[model samples]
Target: MASSRSRRVEYDRFIPFRSAMDMDYARFALTMPSRPQRDGSRESPSSVAYQKLLDECILKNRSRILAFKSAPEAPASMLPQFDEPIRPQKKQQRRIPREPERVLDAHGMLDEDGLNLLDWGSNNVLAIGLDDTVCLWDDANKSSKVLLQAVEDSGPITSISWSPDSTVLAVALGNSVLALVDPATGQDVNVTEEDENQTPVLSLAWRSNSILTVGRSDGTVVDYDFRKDDTSICFYNGHRRGVCSLKWSALSGRYLASGGHDKLVHIWDACMPVSHHHPRRHQWLHRISSHTSIVKALDWCPTRSNLLASGGGRNDHCIKFWNTVNGACLKSIHAGSEVCALLWDKNKSELLTSHGSPKNQLTLWNYPSMTRAAELSGHSSRVHFLAGSPLGGVVASAAADETLRFWNIFETPKTTKPELPFAKFSVIR
Candidate 1:
């Protein structure tokens, strides 16, 4: 027994125990199975001591091992990689389809050159010039009446325009005169005629309550101020032929656009003082002669102030959009026929154009892109005039067929609103 004890102690000295944390020592000590001694009993003292030490070591290190495993600050190299990559979010695009809600017939409408035949008032009244008569049609009540008539000697009514307040209407006659009439009573409030030079008034546009610009057959536009003692302010001359179309920009009250049979478009600053001594009576911003035929279709963009769109006659068959600020031609589209009139959508970025020969149709277009949205064909003759209602999204077109057509092309879609037809669209806006 003494000799066996000595041998066991010598084996323990060869083990070289440094610390209990050594994984190899712990595995060897803890995993070893008990063996029977020479006396035929179970575990020996050295083996028993090792088993107790291993148990104590595991108990002491339990909390530390658990804490290290649960910590979140693990190195990047220890993180697992993913197979699939993340994608970016997609944006939704808005696309409005081309469709008409309804169309109406307007009889006794005229198709004349150098005439502002159709106009829509804020009170929802549409005034149309038919031959020598001026007619008023109530859009809300759907009624029509003869507003005024000119004698055969005085010639036919050439142009008509409603005031901003919808109270007064201006009627241009072929006899070089302009008659301001109250639509409520169908009576002339005042009549203003051109000077003795005998130039007839062809087109008329009202800029404000005090300002009226009249385009003449002598290639000049006369500014009439209601506030001044001498109502005839001055004349602005540019075109070499009859000025057929005149429009004042709503965005900038000072900007005016005039087109004529001379195949020229003149952008003028109307606010400039008329001085014959200054060499240039009118402040001409741009003189665009891109049209090969009569440039009668002229309109300023309501959404964009500096953008202008003009259409040409049968030979040109093109609608060109211009940037008034820089005098640049932004876009141009061929209508396949003569572009006679233009109307810009107020609530949306769209354009409505009327054609004369070949097609004689009304076309709805998307702005900037100049893409055709839809083509409305009904008129048997040339579609020459277009007017928009202040009630929103309703347009009335007059043609040479002596018919006026109403179209709800820009009407807003509403599924949840009540059936208040007249006020529904205006209320939503």
Candidate 2:
């Protein structure tokens, strides 16, 4: 064992320097002495001799002390160098454009240079065109050629509907008349011609072989039957505003669904037909007042006629599904932006919607399940329209960017065949 005094001495000798060498050495060398003694004298020194010795010490050591005090700090230069090696910046990732799954490039078929409306025929052909001209395309063969092109009076074609058998095409034009044409021969049937006073026929629906329903922007729904020979079987004046959408139910020929700018959906029955003279010929079935803005589009489930879906002009930017029989809302699907177009998948269990301003996004959802399956965000603008292929293998979307996008929804493997009399639902936002 060592003594305490010796241990203290060892600690002092071995201890590391507490400060930089410049600070410690400069402090020691620059300290001033209290007083100085005369040469070989044991008595108090004279003031003059003390002054002289003090001056000499300061002058001799001043340069050496300053050199030590001004020494450069190593840590200042080393910190930045150490940081550079430890944390390097990362490179940003870039997005690549994808190839379209299918393209519909054939021209001279749609109404004008651009397509205004499109509908699928019973035979899987696409019926589309601008005012007064209807063209049909065989979807299976890219080069199959235009199957039929029917030309009517010179006016903008607002809407088109194919007969259930795909044999007849009903067209509504700005001329305020409805024309039925044979798709196989491009022959005009000349069903009815009306005066220009009943202007802007916005929507048309074929109820049966004998009856057709026409909804006008002036808020009138007219039922014209060929069996009656040009007679207006029913005239609906209940819509307080412009009618935007119309549909005839396969389940009940008398039950017609109409949506309008009034943000109300009115169900009319054909069992009781009112004349233009009778102010109350139309009977209102159920009115849906859920939409806050003008209801842009609506569709009854083809398989489940009782299930109805509507979209557009909602504050939440969502699509609502309802039980048409009971007028009860079944489910609502939330989307990132206002849904511009809504379509039902071939399975009838899923819904496809397109959104985004300058509209470029496409999303798929499983119905009732209300879960999103996929999101397609490649387009830079709002998607204006969407159409699903009859075979359920593909979807086509149009945008204001002057481009069309084709999506392959059937890229995933399927396990079973879809059961029919399919009651799939469709909604357009």
Candidate 3:
């Protein structure tokens, strides 16, 4: 009975089995009987023996029920709780605004929307205007007004050219007629017998006092001689496409270069003039098949007359310099965008090209070396035209963004470092 009491005390101590060892022992006792029977009968002894076994089984089962219920009610501090909610942090975004473009002027400022720019002969003057009105201003005279104005054409004038002497100004009208006006008198010459085919004159160049070359969209280069009064001069028709650019060399007056939509730069000897009554006798000097796109602009270097620069066309972003004598590409510069216009600096050693689309960028390059010199960025749209002053003081650029900007090239400060304070001192402190 003392042993039975000791066993009961041990069992009771482990009544609430919270650990795995206690629970395993409890399961083993429930599955196996505590005592074996001496009789041959499979059943256990009856009465007191059965009651003792029944009581032990009931106690063990009751303890298991109590432990399962109390296990869930234990303090949460003893174990980690997975049901806790978490909050996330919010992020902040910053916005940056774009900056507006600004223009700088060294001498004077002109109003916007002025197109068709021309630098007058030898004088520090410029002519610009729209429709029938033209304004000429002297850069030397601050108080001077428009030097000349004329209403010479009925339709809007599409093109303007100054004669070699800068005495006569020729205006090409939108209606496919040409008018010659005197800049000093603003009077139009009545030389108005229009060509029957009358295509819009795309470009104009003055070859001499007697001959004026006009390029049309019909791929015809016509010469109008002021010396003859009866019929028009000879028309040279070799370009199978519309003429986009024309240049007459100042060194060799007979050599004429024209670029067209056919992607070929045709060099013609204008000296072999054909009479209006006879067939054309002009000989093709050389053809440059360098540009793969339409040539929009061509400029002959004043210092190096044999070197010619041409640029423009869709997706063509290069400026090519060609030697007219041999028809070889001397050098090419990648402008990284479609080159719309090109101008040689007054010194003829540096070339400036204006690119369009993606960005309006102006790039200057050392001519024969093709090395990048500088890049000017300010325009917001496609730069369509660039004109450099003969005096090398200023450069004027026009863009589709409805603004004209004048860059003062002469105002660039020299890169000499300032003298040190000690170096400038005399013998005394």
**Which candidate gets the maximum TM-score versus the true structure?**
1
TM-score for each candidate, following the candidate numbering: 0.72, 0.63, 0.63
What TM-score would candidate 1 get against the native?
0.72
* Residue ranges of candidate 1 with Cα displaced over 4 Å: 1-108, 193-196, 272-280, 413-429
Q: Clashes in candidate 1: how many? A: 1
lDDT of 2 by residue, 36-136 (tens): 23354554557656755766776442434356556464757565554455666787632222445655543332312112356776678776653345556
Q: Pick by lDDT: which candidate is best?
A: 1
State the local distance difference test value for candidate 2.
0.65
Residue pairs with clashing backbones, model 3? none
For candidate 1, lDDT tens digit of each residue in 189-296?
Answer: 888755477688778888897678888888888888866678877668778889999989988887899999899999988666656685436767899988999988
Residue pairs clashing in model 1 are 106-404
- Local distance difference test, candidate 1: 0.81
Task: Identify the runs in model 2 with alpha carbons over 4 angstroms from their true place.
Answer: 1-100, 105-116, 144-153, 250-254, 270-280, 314-316, 356-359, 377-382, 401-405, 410-429
lDDT of 3 by residue, 322-427 (tens): 8877888887766678777777766547777877778787777776788866677778777766766556646767676656566664223235788887786777
Candidate 1 positional error at 110, Å: 3.3
Model 2: per-residue Cα lDDT at residue 154: 43
